[model samples]
Target chain A: MWMIDLRGIIPAATVVGCILLIWTLAVIPMNAHLAADMAARGDVVVTPHSPQDRKAMTGVTIAVKNPVIIAMTYSLDRPRLPSPHQVAVEMHNTIFTVAPTSRRSLVHHAWVTLSATLLGFVIGTTLGVLLAVGIVYNRTMDKSVMPWAITSQTIPILALAPMIIVMLGAIGIQGLLPKSIISAYLSFFPVVVGMVKGLRSPDAMQLDLLRTYNANAPQGFWKLRLPASMPYLFTSLKIGISAALVGAIVGELPTGARAGFGARMLVGDQYGQPMVTWAALFGAAITAALLVGLISFIERRTLNRMGMGAA
Target chain B: MTPATITARNLDLTFETNDGPVHALKDVSLDINKGDFVSFIGPSGCGKTTFLRCIAGLEQPTSGDISVNGMTPDAARMARAYGYVFQAAGLYPWRTIGGNIRLPLEIMGFSKAEMADRVAHVMDLVDLNGFEKKFPWQLSGGMQQRASIARALAFDADILLMDEPFGALDEIVRDHLNEQLLKLWARTEKTIGFVTHSIPEAVYLSTKIVVMSPRPGRITDIIESPLPRDRPLNIRDSAEFINIAHRVRDGLRSGHVDD
Candidate 1:
């Protein structure tokens, strides 16, 4: 039997379809000025022949007056809002037309971003779990470290990212390490919170059962606490991965990194190519979705085999 | 004559809560012998489970003398002298029935072969033979409880401490488990300390029944069952069983009046 129900796809798919509908409808108005300018250049009868005058009128008025220009809105080269189809074509071309090693390829940029995300996620999860263990086992650490962990997350990653990048650069550590550090910083908080909850998930009776066996702390951890935390671990991993991806993309943006989704987005915005920027945005989204999907798949397999699938 | 496997004298436990010092156990004393099936039956807050926990070294009595196998309760616990079953089955949801049964063995560092052997044996003992790979959620409540019992029995600990193991089940399931429990007790011949609020449950399984009551929990009466070792389900309806059960009820009522 398949783990996920085919019917389960309908709800999420319907929501995506609705979003696309709304987005596609919004496109006409958003691109109508450019369409109006093109319509005037073609000498298609227009209320205002001047390109500058079209900008003063509402897009709805422009679109309503020149119905022929409506179709033109969906095809502008670099309109204020690129059509979804245009972004899709850009994404497909950038992803498939060039070799994966090419800098222009969306896949290459996505891979660069993903490498940092995966690296940071691994480090963050390990660090988070270690901190969680310390918090759970030692009262001193619980009281002292937990407050700091909570407070650390309050410092917005955007504000901290530049400082981290510049500090690491000043120390002769550049490129992937700085980006990974930012990603790790973003990812660790959820893992710490989720893992602490997971490790302490076992109740008094469960702990007492271990006590009766004269099971030492290590035995209790391995036999009870660790296995008990698997569900929580997976939950945090999914959240951490998305955060890591965001961190990597953010790290790429202000640092002038030459080869990641954030850099592509930055370059596209600067060059006034909305299609390139939109493609990079979609690429980052797809990467995050895939990474989260992989974690969920692993979670199901592990929890099912471990008999904690229902949990 | 069976050796006294567990002994308690003047077991006083107080909890200094915000309300006041709640006397959880007061002047509670009892003796349980090797191979004896003893039941601690009482109302809620009667410290029956607390006393059991004291024996398992899960609780500390402020002023008390308690021993398990001639050692301190904590020492006996660290020595792995007992296995305890909680009110709930409390099986780890992540482990298979077989793996849950093997937990104690694994904890004690048994050889891999020995672990597998003990797991198989206990699973068979609990009639969970084919459920070696089945998860805890896949099993019914009774089966999960059985798996927990098997888990407690996996190692060589001679004392089995159970706190309301069958209390959650319906009458039919509880009856069946109680029967199976007696057989398990007879077969293993381990010293068993069972806690229950049910009078019939206390009367049916225990060789000695300790009747207790609350408001500062204390023992009222200790009744030794006149029923024979080999008893069937129909034995509960017999006059002898009813006679013992009536005395237990009287003991309980008298303790209630004492408060």
Candidate 2:
């Protein structure tokens, strides 16, 4: 088990390391102009050498030969692209340095987003399951509702997010509710598709066995369809939770909200502090990974208990 | 004379597919007496399974009359008068042997204690007593099939409809299971309608052998076995059994010729 875990971790760590290396390397060139200006203004003195010496250097050679200028790019107050360490430090400060209840803390913002995500996930799962059941049992629903459900996903979430927030706000509903509604909208599709396939997974022979017992629709659903759908449902829930997090973050974007990761991103963008936005983005990513991990853990335990053996 | 547990008169079943209407069963007729072990032997697509399905009310005949225990097949199904076993074990993988056996009893609203008792009784009949806790995947294919049979017998139905239940097992397993099944039939005395393609198996287990032909499946011959009720494994070596097996083979050949 340890070997298997190490095998999985090695590849993942390599990919993350590569991404960080590239990001760190790119930041120096991307923020070179800003760093040069900061040096000229004398607000930041990167080196003892005059601005004229730095001006003499050009492009790749300047980045390679001048360690001070490269160092300057790593510590800029308002960088075009924040260095990996800058984002990590900002994330650490916002997440751990302050009280969790503080508006400025990423922990508090994540909590606000997480609450909306959880609510939306529950609502979406319920709706998706119900629709799937209806589609499986009723031919008309399968024919009509399935097409609409597929088409509904074709509409871009970015285009729909503001409209939903505005319309819901017009009805005097605001904040978490609108964001949750959007989350529900985004997350439910996977559940519906997965559930429909799962519910119908039992073959004709199994169905015939149930028929021989004279099992009714409700009995069939409860005993056979529902249990059969479990693996599929869990798979979809993993996808759904991640989508719900995305929805919660995007839902925050249109509202100009005062809390949540999306709000933090907006404030950072407006204030020209890329570190704040990158920190919030990382926080959302970590939250999504955690949610998916939690679902997978539950799935393993449930499927294993049901004799499905880690599927 | 024992009353007919299952009676089908000129039954016909045609499945409507996109390609065309496929005739699965045509003019198939048989009478299964109470406590009788009847085996339907035929090639693939011979509608022997369709006939068994008709008896179990899993399939509806396009025309003609079929009855189980003097009532319509559908009514008998609703009354839980029969248990149908499929070609495959069809045991739900998620359920343990005990759980699978208890499924029918649960559906029929048997009390918890009663369900447990019935499950235990059937498991013992199938010689799967200690295997109650094992899931279908944990068991051998033959064992899984036995558990499926145990599941069917749990509700104490008067008739057991089996569609090639041992078709997938190896020769040794099939022979062993065939003997066990004969013992089960003797102990339970439930009228059984079994579908198979093996002539020796038909001769060894059945009170009656039904030879059928395909391409619009029709019964070619129905041979009443002269074998004794109590059959031992060595009975397959007897002249009487060989003679009966030969007759079944001839009937099967005639079925093919007619086709």
Candidate 3:
């Protein structure tokens, strides 16, 4: 089992390693301006050394390489692109070093965004399921509502976000409600489409069998359709949760809110702190990955209990 | 008179499609008595299964009348007068074998104790004992069909309508299941309407064999078996059984020739 697990881990680790190598290489070219400025100001003390001497030097020794430019890129105070370690250091400082309740801490901002995401996910899932049931059972709803649902998604969320935030603000409904509404708007579509497909998954033979038993519509829905839809529903929820997080973060961007990952990015951009922005972006990504992982965990347990093994 | 358990008078069903109207069943008439093991045998598109569905009230005849236990098929359906077993087992994969069997009983509001007792009784009748907790995928194709048969019998309905239930199984398993079905029929004493394409299967299990033709499906022959009720598998080798099987085969050949 451990060997099988290693097979999966090895590919993922290799991909991550490749990405880090690319990012490290890209940083040298991107931050070359700052490095050049620092060198001109005589801030970089470069000591020329032989390759053998460089190998002999201790860890504390600041020996510049043959190019001398690559070493300057690693220590720039204001870089166009921060190195991976620079972002890591910034993340550690904001997430662990500071108090969690402080606005400067990444944890506080992430918590604010997460609350909206969760609320939106709940509302969106409920609405999506209800609409799916309606669409499945009634021909009129299928003909009328489905096309409109698809049309609604074509309208870009980025273009719609600021207008929604501004409109809600005008009506004095600020803060979490507007953000959550946006999240719901983005997340519900996948659920609606997935659930409609799931609920209709049972074949004609199964339906005829139910009819032979003289089962009513409610009985058919509860006994056959609902259980059949569960696997599809969980798959939709995974997609919906990630989309909801994106919505919440985007919502914070236009509203100029004081606390949230989106607000942190906005502040970082305005104040020219690329490190802060990179840290907050990574924080949001980690949060989204964790949320998706949690939903997958629940999905596995539920499907297993239903005897639908693995999926 | 055994008091006909099912009677059809000039029943016709025409399905209207975008292309045109297709006659699935036309001018078909038959009578099935109580405790009868009747098999409808025909080629594909012969509407043998359609006739069974009409009796189960899953399909409606365009004209004429069909009655079950001296009432309309719809009324009989609402009364839960029969159990249907599809070609595929059609067992809900999410539910265990026991749970699948218990479904109709639960829908009809049977008490918990009664449901448990009935499920166990039917499971034993189908020889599916001790497999109550296994899901449909965990069981073999033959076992799944047995579980389906057990499900239909769970409600203690007076009639069982089976649409080629063992059609998907291998010959060895099908033969074994055929013997079990005969035993089940003897023990339960219920009227069964079976549909099949195999002549030997029709001869082996059915007390009455119905031969039908396609292109507006209608019955051409109805042969009543003179064999005893307690039939073992080796009975298929007997002179009488071979004679009956030959007649069924001839009837089936004549149906296609007429077409």
Best by DockQ: 1
Instruction: After the best TM-score superposition of candidate 3, give how far the Cα of residue B124 lies from its true spot, in angstroms.
Output: 0.9
RMSD of 2: 2.6
Instruction: Provide backbone clash counts, one per model.
Output: 0, 0, 0
CAPRI classification of candidate 1 = high
Q: Point out where model 3 deviates above 4 Å.
A: A1-4, A43-66
- The full ranking of all candidates by lDDT, starting with the best, is 1, 3, 2
lDDT of 2 by residue, B43-135 (tens): 998898888888777788999899999999899999999888888988888988899999998888999999888988999999998988888
Clashing residue pairs, candidate 3? Answer: none
Please give the TM-score that candidate 1 achieves against the real structure: 0.96
How accurate locally is residue B21 in candidate 1, as Cα lDDT from 0 to 100?
92
- The regions of model 1 sitting more than 4 angstroms off are A1-4, A50-53, B1-3
Q: Each candidate's root-mean-square deviation in Å?
A: 1.8, 2.6, 4.9
Candidate with better DockQ, 1 vs 2: 1
Using Cα atoms, each model's DockQ against the true complex is 0.88, 0.82, 0.83
User: Residue A220, candidate 3: how far off, in angstroms?
Assistant: 1.0
Please give, for residues A95-172, the per-residue lDDT of candidate 2 as tens digits. 889999998899999999999999999999999999999999999999999999999999999999999999999999
In terms of DockQ, which candidate is stronger, 1 or 3? 1
TM-score of each: 0.96, 0.95, 0.95
lDDT of 1 by residue, B1-259 (tens): 7668999999999989999999999998888989889999989998899899999999999997999999999999999999888889998887788888888888888999999999988888888889999888899999999999999888868999999999999999999999999998888999999999999999999899999999888999999999998889999999999999999999989888756
- What is the alpha-carbon lDDT for the whole of candidate 3? 0.90
CAPRI verdict on model 3? high
Best-fitting candidate, measured by TM-score? 1
